[model samples]
Target: MCNLIGHALQQALTRRGFIAGSAVGASLIAPMMCSAVAGDDELDTRIEIAQSSGDTASSRTRLLLLGTAGGPTWWPNSDQCGISSAVAVGDAYYLVDCGEGVGKRLQQALLPANSRVMSANLRALFLTHLHSDHTVDYPNLLLFGLFTGLDRPASPLKVFGPGRRGQVAPVFSLPGSSSPTAPIISPDNPTPGTKDMTGYIYQAFATDLNDRMRDNGKRSLEALVEVHDIDIPQIAGFKSPNETPAPPMEPFRVFEDDRVRVSAILVAHAPVWPAFAYRFDSEDGSIVFSGDTARSENLIKLAKGADILVHEVIVTRWIHGLFPAPRSVAEEGLMQHLLGAHTPVEEVGGIAEAAGVKKLVLSHIVPGNATREQLSPAGKGFSGELVIGRDLMQIGTGQAAAPARKG
Candidate 1:
């Protein structure tokens, strides 16, 4: 039955064309990529249902596994190239990187009820960096939030990330596109970067807001969407090649309300400078979401002893083996970037061990095409509890508030 189920799941994954370039030795490898039934619409309904039942806890410190696989470049099917990102539930809704399909995933997980993520409430979007796969949904989230009524004048939202004026503006508000161009995001510093993507995201939404309000009855687009730029690299540290001049790292505190507190630090995801990892500490427990990074001591320092370290992982051996011969030089060349850009399974374990974290949630799993053995490399290296995350999988941190243990 397990084999049959695996076969079925493999078929579903292949139909989506999310397969990798390598050929698998067995059907078992195929099952790793299963169909995630809960799309954004579905999640939205669930949240609405949960809220209507007076279940505020549903929107509490719960972590919703929205998009687990990375880099397929499309939606759930686009698993190959995308990096991992997630939605964290707190007093207000907080989005980890808005990767590909994240808007839809958020839509599926939010909306419908009079909850915090309804038509006009947003906690903030915490970003690790500006990788295309990790940030593809930036424009979508901004546009959808406004279109779906989630973003309105009264419900200004926020987007946080490392600042890069040249890279962010194009995506935040496309040049010559109908969207409103924002004031340069990132802020003044000796490092030379923007405030954050918030301003640019809002500027992009401006044109959409005008069209929506003029077309519909909604008034005041600015009220609906608000942007708070966070200079990540300045506070954290920018990773760059030693031979080249490195952009100064900027890491800073984003928010610290009674409900949750967020802090960031820079990590090494070279060539692509100014990457980050965020630590969201709440009363119940804490979670550290690594944006997209190779191995880094900096990340371990930031995540020390946290309940969950939501980090990205890749199969180093399998990736290297895929193009092992002289004939596959081109393929090997391509793998180098991915291999070097992401953390290997053993590295994840090492990071967890060094940080003294009790649990590790491996996400943004790369080459979603690897065998089960290859896919779950982190499990073998770490003795502490480890989770090979799947979309929609929820990890609980605090003990289910129970009656006091009878002493």
Candidate 2:
């Protein structure tokens, strides 16, 4: 009787294209079926629903997840891209990071890609750190914005991030190389901060910028971008790479406009000092982004009373399961680095609890394409609204606080 019931159910699902010949086939078919059901109109409706729930759609701030994968490497046939997000307030948008493939993702989010209004509305980009995964699309975003009709920003496009870390020890030595114990080489001066990096990027694109200006009558890209290097107060135990120590870890304002006021705090993503977590406050509500960090009290404090706390998370269980038990020295070292730099999923709940945040949205998720069952272990302690972030998910920041919906 059980076999007969199972067969009937399978047949029903197969007819609906939600399943195929076997369970393995079903897994593939299910997503396709879901895509078919949720067409572009459905996606727009989802966004509209979230936007319309509050006092007025125009007054509410919307959070859009552009990418949700954890690391720099994008696996073949993966649904998500790297970690990036956008906060939309009224007509303008503020990007959080420019992870891999962010330009395409942004085009999808802001439809009618050639619309001058849409392109120009991309006001500022705030970077949490200088990790390759997070900044992979920096060039793409900077160049493509012009082609998309972003002529001149209201103000120079502002980019904010932590200052550079001084030279540090190398993580690993090349295989078969002599002097494996040699320390990493460092220049006489400290590492370049965000402002210097921005200048470098501009200079790197000098030829392109020049040609575009002369041929297309375009303005200089350098005239459009401005970078700010945040110097947060050093935590008692922590040291910054700057020659002079930073002031303190208090909530310091980074940017402000009529729509939102942004503040930042230093979070611990060691070996990469001066990592930041940002808080955005508007009349509607507040949202905190816990950029990339391990367990951090500073992050908790920054997120305190926030309407939404978007935190990065890693599941150690899944990570361990990815490799065989008798690990090599290199594998062990990699594991140690990952474990130390990222927040464990189990601890995420505690941080949310301590912060008293209303909603916890997990992004930069390690082991991309993780299922809810796999992520459940992380939510053991806290009971606030938990959301497993996905690319193109949109959430409304308002008193009504509509549940996040896939875009």
Best-performing candidate as measured by lDDT: 2
TM-score to true structure, per model = 0.68, 0.79
lDDT of each: 0.56, 0.69
Model 1 poorest ten-residue lDDT run: 1-10
Candidate achieving the largest TM-score: 2
* Cα deviation of 196, candidate 2, in Å: 2.4
lDDT tens string, model 1, 169-198?
221222354654446524453223224444
Error of 1 at 185 (Å): 18
What would the per-residue lDDT of candidate 2 be over residues 1-407, giving only the tens digit for each residue?
A: 00000011122242311221235434533553343224244222322222223332223587777788888787554567799998878667899988886876666555542344445777788999888888888888887777765677557778888676766535554467554454433354346667867777778888898888899888877777777888665456544343222224678889998888999987777666667889999878988999999888888888999988999999888778866678776787677768887988889888888999887888898877565445655555675766666665566676432443448
lDDT of prediction 1 = 0.56
